[model samples]
Target: MQTKTRRSMIIIAIANGLLLFGYGLSLPFFTIYLISQRGLTSSMAGLVIALAGLSRCVSSGISGELADVFGRKTVMVWGLFSQIVAMFALGLCIELKVQVGWMLACYFLTTFLGAFFRPASNAWVTDNTTPKERVEAFGIIRIGLNIGWALGPAAGGFLVRYSYSMAFFFTALLYAVTILYLNRQVQDNHTPCKSRKPSFVSALLSLKDSRLAKICFYVVVITAVNSQLVVGLSIHCKQYLHMPEYYIGWFFTINGLVVVFLQYWATRLMAKIRLSTAMFIGCALYAVGFGSVGFFDGFTLIALGVFLAGLGELIVSPGEQTLVSNIASRETRGRYLGMLMVFYNLGSAAGFFGAGLLSDYVAPHYLPGPWLIVGAAALLAGWGFWRMRRSLTDEEDGKTNVPVPIKKDTITLN
Candidate 1:
């Protein structure tokens, strides 16, 4: 990689690490907080998160267009600044026991603001790296994110012992630290397009491509399955299994370890397979891991499930980014990527909402109901990918004419 490209990747990675540190700290606790402290039912808590997540999808798409218009650094700085204020207010609400509606509004605002960080940063990575370098580039980025994930939850585990509000306060401070560090060391090397502004609706328009749309829909399925990790696990274990808070924090930590240690190698290995095939495999592993967790007892046994899910994430995350990167026109990279994330967040929205309802009405009556339903959805999603492998393989063949700076890796992905 060129030094400048590598430098940008490193900068984005570190920035992502800082950005996600806050997410790791608070997200696992959010569902429980709403239910326990805000006097909401589990379904209501899930509804709030689902609503916020859906809004975030729209904001994420818009952020991409803004990034293309205003530049990556500008959008990121704006998002981070906004997030700091929102998160600080969220902390105060949590600490002060404010009205549920106000507390939720702050949380919703944070989720919307959070949308700004990823598409902009990921687009920055796309701008710097050639197609051949993107999968590993994204892997490098995920490593930094998981590094934050590893530490943040562990720290939040401790903070939650003192006060959950502390996690929100500390996260805001972390975002400030991130902005300060980034401004000093990172430069806005990517230029905004002058030829024409990308339409804000272009992200929506791009979804007309059936292949991309299907994958996006599949993502909704995967996220619905993945939602159980937070929405269901926290409530289930805490209420029934009596799992301690520290163990839940460590669950996230172990998943982060899987990514930090194995993501690069896994990304390379996955690149050797057909993209759709790899996605299918990822979904299978993800489902099996999630399913097994509901039946297990103790932190160690549960960690095994988390470990497997992490491996699934290691493969799937980079593969998704790489597909969008391969298919995107240079000028439209941000919109395409942002479009993919729109579906990504949509999956989270569906997952959170379904998880909430399942946890409330189904899980209590039939403990395995949530996992069984999600596991079924994941397997079905995997089948969708498996069926699409040949078409996806065909699309990939058409995408590779761009001159590669690096030699083709392994079997060239078809």
Candidate 2:
């Protein structure tokens, strides 16, 4: 990689680490905060989270076009700053002992802001690197993210009990620092926009490669499976497996450490494997990990399930991002990224809400019903990725120099 590109990657990774550390610090406790502090019921807390997911989905509706038109850095800066404001605002609610309604408003706004930068950051990575460097580049970024994920909660676990407001304040400060870092180190990497604004429908429907849509759909299914870790897995551990709350946190800690220490090496090893094959293996791992969770009572078995799921995440995360970049044209990369995230956001919502509903209504008597359903969905989706790969040309896989050009645009790294 060129020096400037390498520099940008480091800056991006650091910024992600800082922001996510702050985010992770407060996030795991948010449901507890709402229920304990605001006196909301369990169902209400889940509803709030589901609503935030919906807010993120709606806010992201046009973010891709905005990033493409205005610039990646411009959109990212706006998103980061707004998130700082939202976090502090939520903290104020906690400090003042405000109504649950107020807390929900702040929560929605915070996640809405997140919708912009999630895609923008990934688009920025695609802008800075070539097809060949993508997996390693994304791997580096994932480690940065997981570092924050690991450390933030460990620190937050201590700080939150002392002062919830203090934890939120620290998170806000981290976001402020990330804003400054991004403004100084990252540049607007998108090409100059066309004179006319493109409508979302036109932009999506205009895609020359139909294969991108199929891949994104698979992304939705897989991500839905992944989302269960946050919703169903925790409940399963506490309710059926008889794991304590403290140990639940340890499970996440273990998952984050595995990703942080192993992501780069894993990405490198899997780089030589076919993308579709890697995805098949990954999705199968997810199925086995999550499915086996329902059948086991042993503590070691539960931990094994968590570790296997993390391994699956390590395999798929970069592969999916690299695959998207390969399929998208320069002109439409941001839009494609945005579209993919819609599925991600919606899938998250589905996992949270769907798992809860299934547990309460469909499978209250059966311990493993929710797990098996999502696990089977993921297993089938893995097969779908393998099926899709059979139709891809050598050019799409970067095995040949033959380019799949749908639009003419100069790619610049600042």
Candidate 3:
């Protein structure tokens, strides 16, 4: 890419890494804190976590429209600042032994604000790059994100054991640094805001393009299938395969580290292919990897399952982001992306909730049922992408920028 773009990508990557690190540092022990220290029941803790998921879904589309109206850098700065405040507030609560209600408020605000800037940052990158460069740009950012994921949980584990307050405080400090660094270094693309258009209904209407709508549906399926990797996969490894808890932990380590190491290479490998084709291959890998888990009997095989799924993760993330960017006009990019995020958040919440239910109810009664269901979702998503491949011909022929007029509350793309 250009020197200017490279510099901007580096800054964006660093900012994303810092944000994920802060979030991850407090994640693993959150439920434990609620149940053990705060005296909440298991169901209450789940309810607390569900509130954050709900906030993300509700805020995503709104934030995307705000990004378009207020400008990407402005939304991003404010979003990061909000996260900083939420993190520090949570930390202070831990230090002061504050009530559960205060912790819930802090958590809700953090998740809500966190949803806002993602589409803005993503749109900022989309604003800055051509269709061809976006895949690599997104891949580099994904690598930076995974780097935080790989390291943060381990650090959080230590900190939670030592002092939960310390973990929250350190994470808050990271967010503060990220806010300062991003505000100083990142430049906005300055797409003119549509002053005449009302945002809420308009943002929802941006998905009127049939192609974009289908892609969003496919994302929901794919994300639902992938979400099994976190809760369902971990439980299956420990409960059925009889792996040690430490061994189960290593499965996630393998997944994250593999993506960190191979994401860019996978992006390069898929760069020359059509985006739909890459997505098909990715979804297929996910189907095969997770489906094979049904037959595996040992820790090594489970690790291999995670590895294949990790490869799929590396291939899918950048490909899908590039596709969404290609489909959107520069002016409505954030809104389109935000619409996509709404589907993603909903899918993730369903997937996690469904996976837990399946693991608890189905896995015990029917060993292969949950894996088969997840694999089926992936296959279904792959088929959807294959059917939608025709829509991507425009991007392939360099017609991705063909203007689509944004009417008062609707976008019509040719």
Point to the candidate with the largest TM-score: 1
Summarize candidate 2's per-residue lDDT along 1-414 as a digit string, tens digits: 578777778788888888878887776667656655676654556667777877777666567777787888888898888888998998898788787678778878888887888788888898888876777788888888888877887777677777887888888889998898887887775775766474676545634456777887888788878877766666566555666545666666667787899997887776676778888888998898887777777778878988998888888888888777777778778877777777678777767667556655555687778778888988988998888777776555544444455544322211
Ranking by lDDT: 1, 2, 3
lDDT of 3 by residue, 1-414 (tens): 788887788789878888777766775466556755787654455456555766787788877888877888888888878877887888888888877778788878877877877888888888887776788899888887877766776567566766888888888788888888887888787765655443677666777788788988999889888767655665576556765444544565677787789987887777666677778899999998998887787878877887888888888877777777777776678888888888887676667667656766787788889898999899899889877777666554233444333224347321
Give one clash count per candidate, in the order shown: 0, 0, 0
Number of clashing pairs, model 1?
0
Per-residue lDDT tens digits of candidate 1, residues 1-414?
567677778878888998778787876787777776667887888899899989889988988888877798888888999999999999999999888789889999999998988898888888877776787789889899999989888878778777878889888999999889878877777777776565765567777667677777887788777767777777778776887787888888998899999987887776576667788888888888888877776888889988988888887787778777766667677777788888788888888888778887888888877777877888988898777666554445223334433323221111
Q: lDDT (CA) for every model shown? A: 0.80, 0.76, 0.75
Model 1 alpha-carbon drift over 4 Å, by segment? 1-4, 393-414
Task: Please identify model 3 stretches exceeding 4 Å from their true place.
Answer: 28-51, 92-102, 192-198, 234-249, 294-299, 394-414
Q: What's the true lDDT of residue 262 in model 1?
A: 94
Supply the TM-score for candidate 2.
Answer: 0.90
